[model samples]
Target chain A: MINNQFLVFVKKEFAHVLRDRKTLLVLFGLPVMQILIFGFALTNEVKNASIVVLDQAKDHQSQRLIGRIGASRYFDIEGAVDDEEAIEQNLRSGKVKMALVIPSGFSYDLAHRNKAGLRIIADASDPNTANTLSNYLSSIIMDEQAELNANVPVPYTIIPEMRMLYNPQLKGVHNFVPGVMALVLMLVCVMMTAISIVREKETGTMEILLVSPFKPLLVILSKAVPYLLLSLVNVGTILLLSVFVLDLPVNGSILLLLAESTMFIITCLSIGLFISVKAQSQQTAMLISLMGMMLPTILFSGFMFPIENMPKPLQAITNIVPSRWYYIIVKSIMIKGLGFQAIWKETAILAGMAVFLTLVSLKNFKIRLE
Target chain B: METVIKTHELTKRYGDFIAANAISLEVYKGEIFGFLGANGAGKTTAMRMLCGLSTPSSGSAEIAGYDIYRQTEQVKKNIGYMSQKFSLYEDLTVMENIRFFGGIYGLGSKDIRLKGQALIKQLGLESEEKKLVGSLPLGWKQKLAFSVAILHSPKIVFLDEPTGGVDPLTRRQFWDLIYEAADRGITIFVTTHYMDEAEYCGRLSIMVDGNVKALDTPSALKEQYHATSMDDVFYELARGAKRSE
Candidate 1:
């Protein structure tokens, strides 16, 4: 039987959330807007980069290579330069992002020695773009070489048959949509809950609630229920945006995703409760939730950075963040089409974190106002 | 008269410092008991202990005939508490606050609605019942908070400096509400810095240095201290407190 007191507390919580239009807007609007922005506006793909080629050879092979590079959508061949100074000037002036240098007798070297020398000079100022651009140019040249020698019998041609599975198109949106979903849900749930609960303290309403007939645990639960429901709606919004707007399909069971989302939402709500109980003011709660939870979730959780590529200490730190496990679970479920069996470990981790956080918050929550 | 609140050597200690020393007092039904003290005189600490918001370091107390320590739930049910700060949800409407507190106190929905409407009409907030509590003036908020605190009609209402800051007119009006509640047979246990307001109590206990320096009717305390007013009486009693050391 449902306690009427608990239901009334929940209703009051819902009324507080609905009455605050600004916080409500952020609760619902932030996830969809972040998904759309991170999906459509942001990308890591090499696309339409301007480059100048310095062909010292000026041979048919160099011209053919240039034509192939120009044909590829990843790069635009500004023009074929004759000297290194022109290429350097083009790169230094920011006119082109990369310069390809083909040495003299390039075709003769390929015919006699079955090899040729080429150099790709890129702007190292932006290292990520530089690395990606260099890889694209090298891959394009490799493809050209493979085509030219398709009919010929060579001693050895180590063709790397790179097959990008799951997201074959290598769409950046696929890599980021789930992450944005996790970050949005975590931020909203944790920050909103923390701030709202501390708001009661700041306004002195928390003392009244504590002195009421309802238990302190029930007070925290009522505060959490509203945010938990709002976060679920946020999950739906993010998923809808991901599937419809970004064209990212859910390859796994929708129910599993929802169930996992609910678990993750609880985990985040527990964190918010812990933060609120520790914080005395709303501003302190907001600060702790953002700097303590949100930043770490985004950075160490592999939402924006790969945990494997992080330094050893940072990788160790990522293990402590709940979002890392939740992010992996979401990626496995949404992208890899994995079932509960494949994601059980991560699901267990999230569930354990939820329990631990809830217990810690419950243990720390004092019924008295001391 | 039946004893509504009774305490024996109620004390609260924080580590080595004794915030509230061994103090004993009793409040009868329908009496306006004023607890007077200077800053850090342990008025709030003693009040918090009696309200079941804090555990005593040593002693026993009962509220509404229920033991404060063992019967905390029963004690909470029989009392209402209002602190100095604004306690209503600023974002919630006036009616919403009423319903929320009413519901939490286990009032049926029909009773809550009827009482909420009656409260709104009584406060002359009929037109502004839907308005957020934050938009109301300070005076209006204080009165509304007092009304909501007593919405459940408990045996006693503990007010911690309920009229700390407001205009003279509003402070006078707030006292009127307090008197009205007291007249309705609810024990009014209040703490205030306003000496003039202290005179309104049927009996007053002025605390100094974590001890009850004086407890008597306003006139009796004035005569005993040979002072012209309660303010002079308080100053004379608290002027030599060891806390200033």
Candidate 2:
């Protein structure tokens, strides 16, 4: 059985957390917001993007090219403006996400079998969408060229029986729901735990807790329990939102989801504890957590981009990011409907990360307060 | 009185700087010992060592008869500490704070509830048991901190400038609590800058720049310096500190 001090310590932690609303917001509210933002806002699927056209060639070839480009739903010609000046003005003003200028092309040249060139400009400000839209435009052009090459009344049509697997129908929200849950939970759990401990230090509450007839680990543990529960609640909220609000799929068992989430919660709490040890004030703790944990989690945890496509150094660093494994676990279990048998490896990795971080932090704590 | 705490040539150094150098002293059971120092005088360092938060550099101290280095867990069980900051959870209700600290000391839930209720009554905080500690006045928090520090009736209590930031009337009330605990056979080794509070100590030690300049009763210290009050004595000693440099 755990020592009675540990129980009381956890109880005190619960009491402390309940009395602080900002802590609740950090642990629960922030996670929910992150889930919503990641799920809804950070989608990869291309949508109605504003575009402009400078059709220098008013010929059939130019019209056909514009028709071919605008025919796809990805680009909507927001304006039909004159000359390169208008195109540049519209593009620079951010009125159009993409712009097409068929530069003085004559249908007579295409009829003479010469190359017909079309200039495509897109708002590459959002690099991901710009790249995706560029790819989609290129593929559409390639498909039309191939159709012309095959030249039959019923040319060969390509039908892809594509299944998006975990995120069928390829909804960006599917990917985001899991990513946001992981990212938010990590930020909330780690940031809150670190800042809470730092607050005690800044306010001189830590010395009282330390000098009491309680073990130091008990004090740290007490600080952890409140956030642990809060993170779980956030997980539940994200799950509900994914199901009810976003209509996202949760094909896996939720108990399994909760189990992995608990591991992540503990993992993040240890991260916060470790951060607190390095910081002397709440402000320092907050900055450290924000810069150290939050940024890295978002960038490397496959939240916005595929980790496999990233550079080799990032791949190496991803091994150290606990949220990377957590995102994998959430995606696998929630989206892929993987059972414990399939996800046990990821779960073990998370457990190992949590145990390792918690132990290392506790060791530092033991040595420092010695 | 038997020795409740003993240190043999205990030294604590921060890098090359000697914070507490070969400091050796003993506190008999129930003695109200005062440790005096200016800011950064190593008084806090020495206190931290005695309370098991810092390890002495090369020597040894025994807390509640347990070796400071080897038996810290046992030492922790028998001692209570209160810093100038009072160290109580301000956001929690008075009773919840009591139960929380009590629980961490391994007290059963029922015992914590029963004793917490009694403690609230004793502190004349019965009406505000449900009130958050943060909302309470500074003086009340100081008293509550001291009471909670020794709620488990530890053999020794260490007060690190426990009366700081409180009014004169409340400082006196806090001393009454310290004296009462000392009278009950609890060793009271305290650190403070407030000279008037030092006079209340049965035996006092003045440290300057990590060295103990004087270790004696307040009366003896006043007599030695030919000063009228503990404040005058401390000022003379502290001013003497500048001249020695």
Chain B TM-score list for all models: 0.98, 0.95
By TM-score, how accurate is candidate 1? 0.80
Clashing pairs in 1: none
Clashes of each: 0, 0
TM-score between model 2 and native: 0.76
* Predictions' DockQ, in order: 0.47, 0.46
The DockQ for candidate 2, computed on C-alphas, is 0.46
Candidate 1: tens digits of C-alpha lDDT, residues A18-84: 8778987888878877877776665456689999888888888778889998999999989888887
List ranges where model 2 is wrong by over 4 Å: A1-3, A34-160, A163-174, A339-345, B242-245
lDDT per residue as tens, model 2, B1-245: 68988988888987898888788888889999999988877888899999887778888888888988787779888999888675888878898888877877777788888888878888899889999898999899999989998888899999898888888999999899888898888999999878888888899899887788889999998899999999988888787554232
> Cα deviation in Å at residue A38, candidate 1?
1.3
